[model samples]
Target: MTGHRLRHAVRRADLPAVAETRRLLRDHLRLWGVPAMVDTAELLTSELVTNALQHTTGGAVLVATLSPGPGPRLRVEVQDSVARRPRARVVALPEDHQGTSGRGLFLVETLADAWGVTAWDSGKVVWFELSDPRK
Candidate 1:
């Protein structure tokens, strides 16, 4: 690849893959010398991956890329075979909150510098980006 990019595949909606995904991202971030982004990047990635696994029938492809610049950009995308979009629910009351069932995208929105969904012919990709603050 021309740039720093790492791609991984999850066989199915396997929840265990989330931990593996985090480990891979952590190693890459360490190699890229952006340890500061590891926490947010891993958390957001877990959310996206979990959402994809829970909502989609097929597996997901995780694409992580680094864009070099004055401020390096780290983007993590989870692509799955589902056309449905994701929405963040407003937790109005404490009782409205379920047992961590619906807050994935909300965390992504709060932490990511920018995030959006891209619809493809086969499915859709949920992606979020985090810029290196040290830059």
Candidate 2:
């Protein structure tokens, strides 16, 4: 694996895993001069993992890498055991939304520089790329 690529799996019980992943992502982006999308990074990870926990029965693996991508796009891939492909829609934000949950894939679709899904062994990989937020 290239030094620019990093990946980790998070058990459903490991909330801290999400945060740490976000930090690593932010650091990577910062080093790349990709701009301060920490807020975006944080929210994006939250949504991806939340969906995995709620919709899938097993844990999720979050993979982040600054690999061969369209210019200025930072790639992110989240793999989960659920075979369902994600749908993107604009829905009214629920009034009772308590925590920063739901609407994970939607954000990925909207905010990423590019986003898509791919087939996995028993599931699928949800991926998104964000344009260089710095410039």
Candidate 3:
């Protein structure tokens, strides 16, 4: 698939919209015979979108871009109007059932081949790219 792109914009109140975005990516990846990554992609998208919804105010724009080159990659961008850059807090790993926090970015880091943040004049976008299993 050359020049493939998928974009979605939804308010925080629209939770189903988020799930639909994930499903769209899952379907596209399935068509590309990368079904193995569907679940991970969906989960990652969910987390990113959820973070944006919880942290921002205006809305969230979830963009799924398929980049074809030497190797294919699925890129997801979640834009938010929040002023702060999405930062990952390093937390101590424990085996007990103590309260924990700030693991969303950690989960993204664990699953994404590459992940980072891009700051815009108005806000920022937290993005993650997963290698296309087909490639």
Candidate 4:
């Protein structure tokens, strides 16, 4: 498949942006013929976007790109105006799940095929990639 890219700018403190990003991701993955990726992709995307908006003082940017190859790979990135990197804490499972917070990066690390953070001069970009299993 040919490469396809989708980008969305998220405003600071815009909680609804989380859902918007998920919707955009779901639609694109389906259109790209990677429906199997919808659930995991949306969940992980939401985690990253929520982290960016919640932790940064400024807005964030969401970019989802589909790389062309025998097994198409989807890369989703959430860029924020903070240089600090995100860390995945060791959640105590059932107990930690009781809290109303934490566990974003933990979820990403557990689900994504590959994920990382890149620090830029102005901020950082947290991203993850999910490869099409059908391929």
Candidate 5:
């Protein structure tokens, strides 16, 4: 498989930016001939981007890369202006808890083939990878 990449700058905390990121990932995966990855990729991308925007005061950057191999792998990364790495906690929701918050990293850890956080001098990047199952 040939490698492909897309990088998007998310500058706003508005919902539209999140939606646009999903659309961009969908289109890129389709063009890369991996439509099967759209659903999981979009879901994880939304989680990471929303987490970044909601937690940081500055903008975030989303980068999606497709690596070349017998079984191609897609890596999605969101970089924010914070060095604090996010932790995935298994919290028990109260019976009356009604909000859908605080499960982003859990979903990522559960679904992605592999995931991790890389801290840089400026900020940190939360990333996850999904391999093409059909390969």
Candidate 6:
């Protein structure tokens, strides 16, 4: 499955979109024969999608691509029409961890092989890549 890609447009940050995103990703991962990564992929996708919906107005786009060769690396991106970038805040105190918000990017940074944000004319894209699960 070289050069395989999937893209979806989300109209709003509703529960349905979140469920749809997970379902699609899970299905594609299954098709790609990488069941091992389905959990991580789905969790990361939810985090990114939730962030896009919470921070920005309008809609967002979700993209997933599988590269060529034995590695077959996978990259996922969430694009939202918002200029506000994500930042990993410092939690100096133990109580700070109890906050209800501000931990998505931290999880991305911790789990993703590489992740970053790219700005476009209308919005920005937050993406993360996962290496070959077989490796």
Candidate achieving the largest TM-score: 4
Give the Cα lDDT of each candidate.
0.84, 0.68, 0.78, 0.87, 0.88, 0.83
Name the regions of candidate 4 deviating beyond 4 angstroms: 87-97
lDDT of 5 by residue, 23-69 (tens): 99999999999988999999999999998898877788999999988
- lDDT top scorer: 5
Descending-lDDT candidate ranking: 5, 4, 1, 6, 3, 2
Question: Runs in model 2 with CA error above 4 Å?
Answer: 1-3, 68-70, 82-101
lDDT of 1 by residue, 13-100 (tens): 6999899999999999889878899999999999888878888888899999998877889999999995475444333335557666
Model 1 per-residue lDDT at 20: 98
Worst 10 residues of 3 by lDDT: 85-94
Q: How do the predictions measure up, each by TM-score?
A: 0.87, 0.71, 0.82, 0.89, 0.88, 0.88
Tens digits of per-residue lDDT, candidate 4, 29-120, equal: 99988998899999999998888888888888999999998889999998999646554434445753676677788788889999888887
Per-residue lDDT over 1-135 for candidate 6, one digit per residue giving the tens place of the 0 to 100 score: 558788999986575788899999999988987777788889989998988988887588999998877777889999999547545442333554787677787788778888888877777899999987776
lDDT of 2 by residue, 4-87 (tens): 666778786565677777777777766765556567766787777666766776778888776543445556788888556555
Worst 10 residues of 5 by lDDT: 83-92
Clashes of 6: 0
Candidate 1 lands at a TM-score of: 0.87
- Residue-level error in angstroms, candidate 2, position 23: 2.0
Tens digit of per-residue lDDT, candidate 3, span 22-96: 878888877765677788889989888877877776678988887777577888898888556645543545566
Per-model C-alpha RMSD: 2.8, 3.9, 2.5, 2.1, 2.3, 2.3
What's model 4's lDDT at 10? Answer: 90
- Residue 43's lDDT in candidate 1: 91
Residue pairs with clashing backbones, model 1: none
